[model samples]
Target: MLDVEVSSLGPGVIERALGCLRNGHHAETDVPYATLSSLLERAVEAQASDVHLVPGYPATFRIHGELAPVDGEALAPGDVRRMVEAILPERVRGRLETERNFDCSVAVSSGGQSHRFRANVYLAQGNWCACLRHVPTEIPTLEWLGFPDALAARLASHSNGLVIVTGVTGSGKTSTLAALVSLLRRDASLRILTIEEPIEYLHPVQGGSMVTQREVGRDVDSFADGLKYGLRQDPDVILVGEIRDRETAQMALSAAETGHLILTTLHTRDAKGALTRLVDLFPQDQQDDVRSQLALSLRSIVCQHLLPSAQPGQRRALALEVLHNNLAVQVAIRTGKIETIESAIQTGKREGMFLLDEDLQRLVSAGQVTLETARRYASDPAAIKATKPAW
Candidate 1:
């Protein structure tokens, strides 16, 4: 049953390694390094979200938010290095040598379908360790990612404004952003320019819209520089991968103000935090001015979290909070009254605004997730009670 067909590696090697899954065969320490590719192929077949390769440990996969070790011998330091070299791109080799940390993507095609993985290889305890996250080749729709269709379309229908997607690491931010890009592609005349650290989902020309993508280290020097030159390329919409620094944030706002739709992501826990984090990146003296720019150019904020699901066949459920820029929200941002933003979201439900805690409660009430699961991740635990829930 373990003789899985794979196109990315030699048939003999694939069959041998996969057969080990059932036969309990362990890799020899001195053998040629053919198991790495086979391991990746198997990881994909299993639908694992991530693969971990570390020295002195067996290969591991993260499935359904849990880590499980593969049935193989522990990898030596030398084995880990060989595995890294097998998939590491030639262009990033120099950067890895100098900085000892880098981000890249690798593609493994099987049966005419391409599967991409976002990889980060870095030095830990004087040895190289790597984490590879699987990225699906075809972009999923917004609804499939667990966004309300009406709300998702409203966020995408805007021709010119800033839309921010905030979430913690491994919370599906990149996939959600890519889904938004796919929605905008329905218009043939719009030109989309995406600057990603390592391009994840490849976008081909669709619906007549021109899609141009650039990688940070490979295609462009940095996100800021990409935005600087991308504006000159006559793009109607720009996707800045993540606003990591002040320059990128400032440039994104400027692009939004100047009649271009700017889409980006922030590492924040909630919608209100997204605004505060962006303003905090600027100097104290200039924060007020940045706040003014943000208030004017902001369109909406969508924050999300993935919690373990109670339903069978569904590994995780998406808990989302959304804030659409209205007069009250704009005033709050302008005056730096960050505390009032939450209240605004509570009252703006008719306008598609919802708080994270409320959504968590909804998920619990509907039995998509358990009460304990919702309580564990709720921003305001007290708001998530057992008596009744809010939609």
Candidate 2:
């Protein structure tokens, strides 16, 4: 014999009661308006780069290259999903549901002060997960980002050819790129167009450059689309947010070949890796064509990383591979002698070019960062001791 539970409610009553329970009792079932506002406020207060809402965990904010959980109750999966849905537009929600992910910019305001957040909401572990990156109201210059004067000057003076900034994720690529764009913005005569998946830094027209930001999924469907349209826009400079695929890579190369100064980022560990990554993006049959175009249009590659400084703050450093497309380097690229390119970078220190290990050694010598940390993140730890300068 089994005991049966009885409900003293009708069909409609039961349905309403269940809905109320789902809304009010489940921790992850919905995100309340008050909670969402508070989270955004906390993010701003802490100067966080990103705010993450995850199920079964407290809200977390990434500040100064570290993720710390906000002092609050853990969120329920359903609650986070509902909260995320409330902030999104109906069309965005519809698209997200249909496509399983969505990307867009969301502006939140309190007391007349507005901050823009680049939001990416996606399905994860059968629940909605959202990450919001804060975008500063004003663009930062190279000085503000702590770039050396020599490097800043070189970036501003480049007339044509490609400039690649390579780094791992959360390594300050966007900030560095923003600084470069800000420098160019001071020039009122140059027309600059940027294609980003979600525009992080907003640059205003100033001096000689007229700045235009096109966001993927908002202004255009893809990077390739934006790149294709950018060619006919009478632009003197182009910034591709990231070269993730061959189409955008080829488009960037084409843009550089046509006398447009192109700036882009790649997720590579070091300068040599940046070159290898670009070449490997193409099919074998197209390797020769890619090598030819790259050798001709290549200008410089700045591979950088952000490490926790010894002074209780984070610092950005560079492991640059500055290829001026000289005969030897061009021959190396064309003839598949990429290993020699590493040697060139090692010996090209006089030309403002240095390898990752060299930069790490400088940082360690300056007491900016520890040798252990540098070695942990370095592309080749063995190269560190070999490249260290004599005290």
For model 2, how does the per-residue alpha-carbon lDDT over 46-88 read when each residue is reduced to its tens digit? 8888999888887899876778897756666676666666566
> So what's the TM-score on candidate 2?
0.87
TM-score computed on alpha carbons, candidate 1? 0.91
After superposition, the stretches of candidate 1 with alpha carbons farther than 4 Å from their true spots are 1-33, 387-391
TM-scores, each model vs. reference: 0.91, 0.87
Report residue 104 deviation for candidate 1 (angstroms): 0.5
Report, for every candidate in turn, its global Cα lDDT versus the true structure: 0.83, 0.75
Where does the lowest 10-residue lDDT sum fall in candidate 1? Answer: 24-33
